[model samples]
Structures are given as structure tokens and as C-alpha cells.
Target: MGKKISFVSSKNRGITLDMLVVKDFFRVNDEKVEFKDVVANENAKNSLVKKGNISIRKEYCKNNTDIICVDGSIAGKLSKNAPEGKRVLIATPYDYQFKAINEYDKGAFKKKNTYKNFTHIIVGSPFEKELLKKCYNTPKSEIIDQVCIPYSWRLNQEEFKKKHYDKYCKHYPMLKGKKILAILLTGELDEDEENPYAEVNWNKIFDNLDEDWIILTNSGKLLENMTHIGYQHRNQFVYSNRTFDTREVLSFADCLVTNSGLYATYFAVRQKPIYCLKYTNCEFEKYMKRKFSNLYIKNVEDIDMTKFSEFTSENEKFCEYFSYDCGENPSAKISEIFE
Candidate 1:
């Protein structure tokens, strides 16, 4: 008998990488699983696999495949169109235009009901599991939380740190000697969706910076004329509009600040000092507070540079809630069922 899984994603690289992490886990467990990469509604001769940079074709989903994932984008449409298989979803709901649970005004009910097609749904948090149950009416049993993602398997931490150091030396050579303050910004998904953090006046936020700031953004675009000019160029503020390698940036960061999103969950797993840039009424805020209450920052003015120097109770709490115990592989648990 052959075990096969077909991973499908529309275009988001992040989701595709998530699928790759899952693929890596299965291979490590000695599972006889053949993986296919399917790009919906497009054709490419060959593509570089996100993990290990192996090259492969954009293959079509084959019959007898056990699972079909509508990763990140095009969940409703692709899931409906996919062939008869065990459908799965890898999603992080943000209550936006591309939200897993959409708004009622524009076919939210119809869209959410489509989730019943999946045999399982993978999420990052306990809060998401409850949200899915409450909002999408998904069965509790189908939502699985395997918090120990195979990120290290995808890219080793040492390699990530080396790349970070190389990038720093080449691009932002001025940023040295000062403590690194990493702020993760949101990526572009839907243009029409209102951003809750838009109310934040960035100029006011960065006016009196306490440390050397590194803006880690998805899009490679930063504010113009924002360069610092002084004799102490060694501790200047800089930004990278590039898609962040989370572990690499975190390896050298003295403090971490981000909005409540997938990256916040990633940060929680590291058991490091974290400062959450609060977004009112955002679904992620609720989840972050539930899992990382001690890390929650209520005010932008209250972001303390000194907090990074010490450990907090939240670090232990975060690990307890979000991290897998030592020598315990949640991926192996998932493979036992999914494979």
C-alpha cells in the first residue's frame, strides 16, 4: 500500500512553506508518503521546494491521494473543486476579508459552512480551535494543534543565524553594537480589509526609540526619508521589507514586538521576552492574551527596553500552553493518524 499526500496552495509562499514543514515531519517519521506540490489554476515547469530548496514540478493532484489541502488562500473555492479525498485546511483566521470565518453581509454563512468538507483542520492555537468551533461550527475532534512545527527541519537555526548576520553586514552595516529590537509587521492579503493598526501613528511610535529598531516586514518596502543621521550610526534604526526568517531575527534580538498573528505564536514558542502591539477587537488579541497574558502590552508608550534584560512568568506559561515538551514530538502524533 502507498501513502500519498497532495499539498495545494494558491500563491501565498507562507502557506506553501507550512505545507512543506508538514511534509518534512512525515519523512522524518519513516513514513512511506509521496508528496506532490499543486499550484491551483497555474502551470509551472519546475519550482524550488521551500524546504531544502529541492527542485520539482508543479504537479497536479492525483487520484488515491489521501489528503488535499487548500492552504491559506482560496479555501472555499479550491476545497469545493478538489477531487474526492480527505480534505484538510491549514489556516490562521484574522477576521479579515480573507478570514476563515467571513462576515455575514457577504456570504459569510455560506462560506463558513463549506468547512464541513474537511476531514481535519490544522491550527496553531487552542483559541483558534474554539473560534472555529464557535464561528464555523466545525466539530471539535477535527481541529488538531501540533504546536511543534518542523521549522528546524526546514532551516536549521545555526544556518538561519549565519544568514541574518550576513544580511546585517551587507545591508545595514550601520546597525551594530546596539540591542536589536525586532518588530514584525503584517503582510498584504486583502487590499479592502481595514487594518486595525492603521490608527497607530508610526512617526509618534518611533519618535523616541529606546533601542536600535529593526522593522521585519513581509513586503520589501519601508518608509522614505526615515534614516537616522548622527555620529552614533552604530545604533541607528533600520528596516527590512523582506519576508522575515523568524528564527534568524529572534536569535539576535534583544526584544521582540509584533501584532497578534502567526508570528506572535512563533514568538511565544521561543520563550523569550515579548511585547504585543495591541489591536483592539482583533481576534488575535484575544488569543494572544489567553496564551501569553504576561507578554501583552496595553500601551505603545509602555514598551520598555529594560523588559528584555529579564525573564518573566509568561515565558514559562507560554511554553506550557504553546510549546511541546522536551523529547515529545507532536508531529509524530499527527503522522500516526494522517499518514
Candidate 2:
């Protein structure tokens, strides 16, 4: 009989995508491997079905499931519920576990050992693995350092353009013959329920941009706020409420300006020109700086707009450092463990 693997993750689209990638790899490579998705979020389930035509299993049983692959530490809670003898594999970044530990330190979790349920943990890099070991004292045997992305491997410029250029041009006709600048800024509500981005100097940032450049963003809130600012280059701004894949927009973009998060990681993996805005002194941001010091811009004033127009060979180095461990086929690497 073949192995029955159950993939699990929270509502996070990125993490869910990771699980789906692994599932897809199994389907293509191993006919004997039977897989099922066990996502709890409706949006995530819908995304899986929409992107891969994958169906979700309402529930999974230990007797039927040979292994439980949990994507991200946020979904680690699922591991505790797995059958006693069932193997649980957790693929996560160090920041997720770091945040959970910080919360646990502040009495958010009742249990002293939150990772007790995990049989093995997969991390992106050796730096991440070392961080986990320092914090959780997790043994080296249980930690696997592998690159984890939604795709089989990082695509070169030619391959990336070939895959997404036509679709992107069709969807965004107005942006044609223009320098596309993609932005992924996360929005958050303040304690008093006021718009957090209202204080930003939107006019200062957009007013200096050339007319030939179009600003593209995924955050609708940012679009709404920037539109209200009535900047000189207001017409050059475009918003994508995730109507299409972000990768499509990124494919043709001359450069990307984003805050520290998964989007930055994705852009880096593509070997594209990117600038990370330092809005806060978060631990993750600090770690990113240590890895790629030149990528960080202090603030809007510090942004060297000329860099966007100039392509450099530095991006290959960034991808090399960022894509350490997992290499081109992290999905296949993980699959080999169970095979």
C-alpha cells in the first residue's frame, strides 16, 4: 500500500501554498503517494481548489493517514491532535516560532513545551535552524534545513518573464510600455481603529516619481489612502486586490518595494531588484539586514530612486544567500524523506 499523507496549514495563503506545492510534487512524481489537504480556512480551501483544482478532506483519521505535514508553526496546534504514533512534519520559518515563543513567554500558552507534538521540523536555512536550536534546544536530527517555497525552484529572468508576461500584460493593459514598480505593504488597524497609514507622507514618495513609472500594490487600503492624498503621479498608481496572482505582476515589474515579510522573500527568490522599507525595528527585519545589508532602506528619504532604473548583479548573491539549504527542489527533498 502507498503512503497516505495529510497536508495541514492555517488560513495564510503563503503557507497553504507551500503545502499545495508539496502535494502537487507527490501527484506528479509518485503514483503510489496518496495525498489529502486538511486546511480549515474557507479562503485557503477555495484558493487550493481555484489554483490546483484540489479538494479538501473534511476530516482525516490516524488509521488512514501515515504522515501529517504541517506547514508553518502557526499550524503546529494540529500536530498535538495527531495520533500518538503518527509522524508530524512541520515546515516553518524561525520568525514564526520566535513570535510564538515570545507570546508563550508572556503567558499566551499554557503548556511549557509547545513543540512537543512535532516529530520533525523543517526550516529554510542553517541560520534559521541554529536559531531554533538556541531557543527550543531542538536536536539536530529533528531539524531539516530546506528551502520552502510554493514553486519547485527559483525561476530565472527569462523563465519568469515567459511564464507570467503575457497574462500580466493582458490583465494590466494600462501598465504596458511603462516601468512597473510592485509594492507589497501590509496594513494593520490601530488600537483606536484609525488608519495606520494615514500619517505616511504619500505625496512626498509619489510626487518625485517619473511619469513613465507605474506603482502597483496589493494593499487596497494603501490604494485608497494614496488616492486620497491627491499626489501629482496619482494616475500612475494601480491596485490589485489579488484578482490575479501577485507573481504575474512581479514578473514584469522593473523593481519591487515592500516591507519585511514573505513577499520580500518571494521577490528575492526571483532574483529581482528589491528594496525593503524599515518601518519598525522588528527581529525579522534585523535578521534580514544581517543577511542582505544593502537591501534595507532607512525610510522614504533614504530611498535611492535611481537604483530602480539600474539593474545590478547583486540580486544573484541575494538569492544565493536566501536560497541556502532547500536549493531548487525543496518539495522533492521533503518527499524523499517519506519515500
Index of the highest-TM-score prediction: 2
| Candidate 1 per-residue lDDT over residues 303-324, each given as its tens digit | 5554544557765565445433
> Per-residue lDDT of 1-339 in model 2, one digit per residue for the tens?
888776654333334545666777788999898776555543445655534322232234323335545433222234335454444454444345445445544556443244444556656544445545544533323666656444424333467566676666677776778887887665344556654455567666666667787778786555556645564565677788668877556546778776645555555555667776654455455644655567776664454555655556565665544545334577766776776
Q: Give me candidate 1's TM-score against the actual structure.
A: 0.61
Q: Judge candidate 2 at residue 243 and give its lDDT.
A: 80
- Per-prediction TM-score: 0.61, 0.69
C-alpha lDDT of candidate 1 relative to the true structure: 0.51
The all-Cα superposition gives candidate 1 an RMSD in Å to the true structure of: 7.9
The pairs that clash in candidate 2 are 147-326
lDDT winner among the candidates?
2
Clashing residue pair totals per candidate (backbone < 3 A): 1, 1
Q: Could you tell me the TM-score of candidate 2?
A: 0.69
lDDT (C-alpha, whole model) for all candidates: 0.51, 0.56
